[model samples]
Target chain A: MNIGIVGLGLIGGSLGLELYTHRQQTQAQISNNPSASPSPSYRILGISLEQKICDIAVKRGVVDEASVDLSLMSQADIIFICTPIAAIAPTVAKLIPYLQPHTILTDVGSVKKPIVENCSALWPNFVGGHPMAGNTQTGINAAQHHLFVNKPYVITPTANTPLESIKIVESIVDLLQAKIYHCQPEEHDRAVAWISHLPVIVSGSLIASLRQEDNPDVALLAHYFASSGFRDTSRVGGGNPELGLMMAKYNRDALLRSLQSYRQTLDKITTYIEQEDWQTLEKQLHQNHSDRLKFNL
Target chain B: MNIGIVGLGLIGGSLGLELYTHRQQTQAQISNNPSASPSPSYRILGISLEQKICDIAVKRGVVDEASVDLSLMSQADIIFICTPIAAIAPTVAKLIPYLQPHTILTDVGSVKKPIVENCSALWPNFVGGHPMAGNTQTGINAAQHHLFVNKPYVITPTANTPLESIKIVESIVDLLQAKIYHCQPEEHDRAVAWISHLPVIVSGSLIASLRQEDNPDVALLAHYFASSGFRDTSRVGGGNPELGLMMAKYNRDALLRSLQSYRQTLDKITTYIEQEDWQTLEKQLHQNHSDRLKFNL
Candidate 1:
């Protein structure tokens, strides 16, 4: 079975490595156990805009074969588009002519609604996917085979999405040993806006606000005194600027709604502080603490 | 030298362990090298409101002696008031009568202005200290001898503060192998408001906002989708409720000013999004990312 992966950075490169390792492990298991059914051999074909990244992917054995041409992906039984959120739609549009009718296609973009709407129209087999993994680190150099292990791999499917396409994606999820979640494209977008995209804006604005401090001495001391809490809180705000912008661009409406709701919460807490209502403030903080604990992830 | 530590929680408990370790190390070094000058023997006396915590501190050997009696702290040459922000002034007031005239007093509270103002008038030798360390974990169980190692230990001194008091605190900083930073009381409060206190409110409000989601389905899905980014961003927000409230209480004016600046930044970002000004939004995000990187801590 041929599996193709495009944009071989962290997500794509790591997926390629995991797929290759899974294939090797399955082949070994079949040889050792005669009772086990023989599985088809897997071949990973990787495509990247950068030749250096493609060469590194090949050198690191992330992919059995690497290419700069999109047409080479036509031979794969399945393909995973792991491009940046901004590029996902355009990349999928560019690859539509090369995608075989029988080949199931998917993506690992954070935002789902727009990508699913754009790509699913061109390719009926397209399934919107988002693997809830990865650190702040990016690039092919940061990719590792175990990146998706035990991570939530959400697949957003429309009513028209074929069951066979989902099955194909599920097979890959199984191979990666990742947990699977199913949701509508809109639900995925809204959920991500609150959990993923919202944090970026919240965190980014935090650091940006400090930069607005009028006092130079306070501003300089703030940089020195930022401890573990401040670092953790502002972490995603320091992430790749282009990526942060794209999430905001593609998931604008839902993210905007989240921002409004978040503003209300901030105002409520501020009022409590202004009024010196420590009881209400403490209660609100305690509730937030409980709510955070509920997210075991 | 006798050292007293009050409120044996994360900062106090950890300080006790570090001080004890440093004393032992110094003793061992002096024994090994005859040419080395002998340092004075150290004694750590820990006091806590909770008897169990005091017992734990003694059992763990974090303190040479532990007591629930606040008056017992009078015997020490120096006292480290490691109480919560709200209790620091009150705790010092209660211990003033027990303190010797020559005894130096300090605190490890996050906020310094109110603490310094409230206690410095009563005790001539009082020096406001804030050890920039600690995780989300609290209590005696979280104490570790190395907690202060390589961490910033900021001392806020007013013009009236004695040079002798600063030198005494410097000796402790050296013993803990931590870096020492000196700033004014107001400077420390303003700086912490931007870096430390502001992040707590920012993070807590992020979690608090998610709780306002009307749709239970979306809320449930958000809980499932909260990834590493959300976890990191909301970390301080989910910390001890009383601690969060006290920071807001003591650093009210500065924190409110920070909140105002932060709200402006958020409004600016939201306007950029509303206007679909991707270029400006991207630039702002890029600038924020650069600013966050500048904080080496």
Candidate 2:
């Protein structure tokens, strides 16, 4: 089955490489622009996603051919949108005319609800996709053929979404060898707000707060003392502020709601601290610790 | 040099193993609790620290001898107080009478001001030491011979402190193969307030807010999608609430100052987000990104 990937950034570029690689071992005809060929009309990323992607593809040997046109979408059985959240809608709107009638469409957006709404509004055939994979590093240059190894890829389909389309999207995710999970669009948004978005704001606030201190020496020590644990907690919080702010804004209500709920949890601990209730505090941490261990991540 | 370690918890137990391993290599005449047998200590940690420490020391051959008695202070050239914050002062008070005339004393408490204060008030021959090594995984069971490897060990000495005592503590840390950092007591607290304590409160607040959400499904999803970054940011925040509270209380004035400063920074970001100042927000985040990279963390 032909799969057309647009954007060719981190997510899109990696997907293209993976699908191209999969075709090598299987009985599939993968069409991608050649690595070295400078397409006269195609817009490659940065210098040339057209050239670099094909070179990587050839080096990794993923696709027989790669290109930069919606004509690629015309031959594809499915199309995956791996662009940024803002670009997803416009890109889909632009490609709808050329998209095959029954082709399944998906995305790798961190936020899902808005993307689903915009895609469904723009195109008759669209299935909401949210792949939960990231590194602090970004861009097509940082893309690895195995970037999504063993990561969760969520597909959120509504009542209007056809079951066949859902399966086709799932099949593509399967080809990428990622763990597939299904959830509602709103559920996806709410989940990300808690795990992904909220952490960024919290961490940014924490680190940003440090910048206010007058003691540069202690600041240096604090940074030195800041180890793996500090890095972990501040990881999401210290992310791209625009992306962080956008997540909070797009999922504002949900995030604010989550924040409210989180405050209550924190307040309980806060009260326990004020009252000096060490016993309960330990119990609460134990619960959080236990809950944390339940997830594979 | 004989090093007497009081309170065989995470820091003490780990130090025991480290000292033992280092002494063996350096062929130093280390005076410790000879009765303190060495073992894997993991099993001991699961039971009780007192027993776990004893067992681990004996099984691992960490000490020539071990004792629970305060007199252990009299024999040692240096004493390292590796206990919780609450115990540091009282332990120092008790050990002062028994310590040798020139004994070098230090601690492994998270906070330094109180320890330094207590040392000054209760004893003259003491220096404040904070080995900046820890893991979320606590207990004697988690003790390792090399837990302090490549970690910072901060030495906070007051105006009254003896430089020789500082040198002794630094030597111990160096022997443990840890990096050394020196800062004043207040400076250390402020630094921790920003990077360490701030993250804890911020992360706890974030996690606590999410727990309050009405939709448990969303909460569960958020928990699932949370990766190493989220966990790191929230690490200190999710720690023992009593410890967190005590930290705030002991360093309340400094912490409050840090918190207020942090609030201001966060307020700036919030205002930008609320104003829909995308360009400003991007620039702010870019600055934050650059500022964060300047630290060694």
Candidate that would win on lDDT = 1
Question: In model 1, how large is the Cα lDDT of residue B200?
Answer: 92
RMSD of each: 3.0, 7.3
lDDT for each residue of candidate 1 in B1-297, tens digit (9 for 90 to 100): 799999898889999888887777778998899788786587899999888988899888789888899888888998999888878889888998899888999999888888899899888789999999888788899998788888889999989988898899899878888888999988888899988888999999899888878878888889887878899999999988887888898899999999999999999999999999999999999898888889985
lDDT of each: 0.89, 0.69
Local error of candidate 2 at A151, Å? Answer: 2.6
Which parts of model 1 have CA positions greater than 4 angstroms off?
A: A41-46, A49-66, A135-143, B1-10, B13-35, B41-77, B136-143
Q: Which 10-residue window in model 2 chain B sums to the lowest lDDT?
A: B40-49
Lowest lDDT 10-mer window, candidate 2 chain A? Answer: A39-48
Q: In DockQ terms, which candidate is top?
A: 1
iRMS values in order, in angstroms?
0.8, 3.1
DockQ of each: 0.79, 0.40
Taking all chains together, each candidate's TM-score versus the true structure is: 0.90, 0.81
